[model samples]
Target: MNSTNNRIVQTWIDDQLDLYNLAKQLGDTVWQEQIVQTLYNKEQHTQKRMQQDLWRVFDSINRKMLELFGQLKESSNSYEVRVLREQVWELKLQRIEIVKKINK
Candidate 1:
């Protein structure tokens, strides 16, 4: 995964903790919104493989989100359910951000 993306902006998907069970693998500690601005750009001109990698990460996040949605529906109203809903929303935002960045 080492590339210009790592050296300059340091936006390694591994570093996003919200991606822990969502991504296939996870490490490091970056806030969900604290990632670099380049990762938010719609046409950053990254390598084709980089875009593919982001898609893979996005897909993984989507899978986790689907599971969360199922649990949200299956459970009754409560503080725990509210927490799960919040998590689902965060994952939704993460997925959208990934989409915006990978159009290059």
Candidate 2:
């Protein structure tokens, strides 16, 4: 990957990581449980919508990584591939954590 693309991807991953941290904080907050119980149906609907949005982002990221992987196979940009792999891993972890929070 060119330096510009690398910077862009890194910035994106950083933003996603920040988002995950905020989400974790929100999930752990005391108000979340009360809100969950008080607004069960609404909470479920919101969670479903959020999950769908996350899935769409996840799918797009996966497709981009796959395309990058093809490029990597043709070249030898191990560092870029590693960075992309880490991003994918972190994104997947965030998705799992969000799902767990919603299910709880």
Best by lDDT: 1
TM-score of 2: 0.39
Clashing pairs in 1: none
- lDDT per residue for candidate 2 within 5-94, as digits (tens), equals 355455555554565567568776555454444344544444455556556666765676677567657756778868766766775676
Q: Which portions of model 2 show Cα errors greater than 4 Å?
A: 1-40, 77-104
TM-score, cand. 1 vs. native: 0.56
lDDT of 2 at 60: 69
For residues 1-104, write the lDDT of model 1, one tens digit per residue. Answer: 34556643344443433354343344333433344443454135345547777889899998999899899889897987999999998998998888988874
Against the true structure, candidate 1 has what lDDT?
A: 0.67
**Each candidate's lDDT (Cα)?**
0.67, 0.58
Error of 1 at 51 (Å): 0.6
User: All predictions: root-mean-square deviation over Cα?
Assistant: 15.0, 14.7
Look at candidate 2 and give me any clashing residue pairs. none
